[model samples]
Target: MDGCTGKIEQEMRAGLRAFFTVPYLLDQGMACLEEKLREALLFGRLTVLHYRAFGGTGAGIYRAAAAVEFMILSLDIIDDLQDKDNQETVWGRLSPDIALNIALGMLTLSQHLLLTADFPHERSGSAARLMNEQVLAAINGQTVDLLNNIESEEEYMEMIRLKSAGLLAAACLTGTLLATGEPLSEVRTYAEELGIAAQMKNDIRDVLNWDNKNDFWNRKKTLPTLYLLQSISDEQRWIADYFAERLQLADVVNRKEEIERIMEESGTLLYSSVRMRTHYYNYLDLVGKISLAPEWKEQILAMAD
Candidate 1:
């Protein structure tokens, strides 16, 4: 991990330790929660990445980054509960009610941490509001995702901007806000681009797999899937039928290779890759424009690369 990500991770561990030591939490299951915190830390590297990229140079951002990590974990728990996938994960292994309780606890903990971060009062206050706004945007996006009501590529992009990019934008913006007391528009643009590009890569992986995490099995309407579905002939309409619940996975599971071929031949994969790279390039351009020293900027860009 980069220095920013590493320091923020350390702070998160310390915060988790402090929170878990509460008498009431200790009376509950401490071992399981400890394991869950370990898992949660893995997802928090982004917060620190943002903190460092946006000029943060002290331990001040640690509390806020920890809050961001907990907020993300809380949402991840909810997403797993809703999707019922990745059963081997900490949240998935536990009973749904227990998972839900943990999610709620993390959500509140995130808020508390954000309000108490060791930043100026004005900056911390604004950061809290921005965080809440972005989270609500993500919730709205998650709602659309769960409903699977996407109708067009444009609509899908919009939903992803809210669901995936919103939180990322908030993370990056929070770092800048804490460091400079002003959130730069270019930083927000770079954050959104990176978030969108990363999500697209995830979508490609999700479509190619053949498990509970498979987006196709889950009937997700990702850009690649929508393109592939529209490009195929009448016989391949069975793919749509499966998505519509007119067929089962067993009937189509054996056709995985064929699906891969179609995705490749139809240019779906290439199209997705092109789209991802476009945003990636844009992110790089913005990084180049940051008013940091050449070496510092190179380090940040290299980290992303």
Candidate 2:
């Protein structure tokens, strides 16, 4: 995987270069921002993973892979703006209005690249449509997540499937659609399950943090947070109070270690990890069911692990 990661970054760099020519983009340093996105090319890697798994062997898929990367980065910028997080990012460093414009530009560039690229398959339209569908679903998820209206772990899982897993599903599906002319349902299921599992892992990490990005500080009703709240003790009233808005994060931030210890004592983190692993194994099972070569299937499973 590491061997191919460099090649993907190189291809993505070439594809991302196309967006820098826009006058506004040039003026806004969006080119540098695009370069920054190259550091984390996970979405592009997923595209390549599916492409190769489905027997795609051309360089053209790199174009579409880069497009997926651009689309994901666009959403990430918008998410950061919505959540007011990762202030060190290019979008974060710039004003929200300017960042919004850059995000839109990236998104448009992704679609343009996808539509205009000379893919070997002629049904590129199907790929574009699927991308749009998944992105729209992600938007709905992001809206609900931002609103923080989740009531149960079931609801949280549903929301994350849309927000996190949807993008992964789209990335994999884009590759499959561009290569096979039809999106494979098994691939979609595996990608979605993997996405949810990955998001749960992230949620576990998020709850352990004590910063602006801390889920606890933000009052995010994640699986672990909900579990932690379910059985609170007298000393844990602050945790409840904080979630209830009776206490501000500033008052509780310094005591983060104490609360984290309490969360650990309550088995919140372990519960979250077990839940994540359960979804992960489900994804692995679905991957095994995909009708690919044994080696390719092994590679795909190994990549996820």
Candidate 3:
């Protein structure tokens, strides 16, 4: 395994050691994510810093600001060490100083969140101090989404834009800061939008595949269903209507072929595809707008491409 992934695996192990040890999982969702992160680190081939960032933040939620900083450390180390063929490029020259700098910067932001912030959590000071920033970001993202969801086309785009993409954008922004000692807000916005669209495609697979279709069963107000509301033929419409009322996975699965055909023919996939491209271009455009170093810009473009 690569050094970055190795670190992720190690971090995950430590987190799980603490996780399963807890009598009742404090937050199952976060706990489950940590577990998944452990498995992904153990199994996958991710050299990216954000992967490690996701892996490393098992110290509860107060360390998002910290997570951002360490992500930069991981990115800088990866860039310095990995060469053209994705082999080690500059491990020998990569300084401990850089690593230390990354940690200190991350800790600095984490501490900043602690001192002064009206985060979401009313009871848990640490949680409010830590995750409140992310929660606020989420709320802001959701606010924009509520406005956009009025239109069918925009609702899908907006859902994908806010849910997963927001964090991805923040992560990349943090990564860039660690590498270049500078921030790029324009690129940040673009990355955020692209991340959302990519995540939507990910969510779509839940329905597309047989693993889970809870989104439909739950009437999740997701983009796919929203798109389907205005899309598909009467035949497709009736099936979704039935599912909306009945909400049984087997009911849908019994007629999966027919439902899938309707979705495909109704242009839901095509519409989603077009929106995804639009997000990517939006990111690319934002990247171009940034007054960043050419080398750094190249790196940003390369990462996205």
lDDT of the candidates, in the order given: 0.77, 0.81, 0.47
Residues 1-305, candidate 3: write the lDDT tens digits: 13544444444334334433444332432333333343333112211332223232222222333333333333333333321122222322335454334334333433343333223343124332323354355446555544433455565555445445654665554433433333356645767766765666665764576533345544445666677777766555665565456555555657767767777888877776676677678777887776665655565566654
Off by over 4 Å in 1: 1-6, 20-57
Q: What is the C-alpha RMSD of each candidate to the true structure, in Å?
A: 2.7, 2.2, 13.5
Report the candidate with higher lDDT, 1 versus 2.
Answer: 2
In model 1, pairs of residues that clash are none
Leading candidate by TM-score: 2
How much RMSD separates candidate 3 from the native structure?
A: 13.5
Lowest lDDT sum, 10 consecutive residues, model 3, at 42-51
- As for TM-score, the candidate ahead, 2 or 3, is 2
Per-residue alpha-carbon lDDT of candidate 2 for residues 123-240, written as tens digits (9 for 90 to 100): 6678888889888999999999998878788899889888899899899898888778889888889989999899999899998876678898899999999899986789788898
- In model 2, the worst 10-residue window by lDDT is 29-38
Return the lDDT, model 2, position 162. 86
Model number with the top lDDT? 2
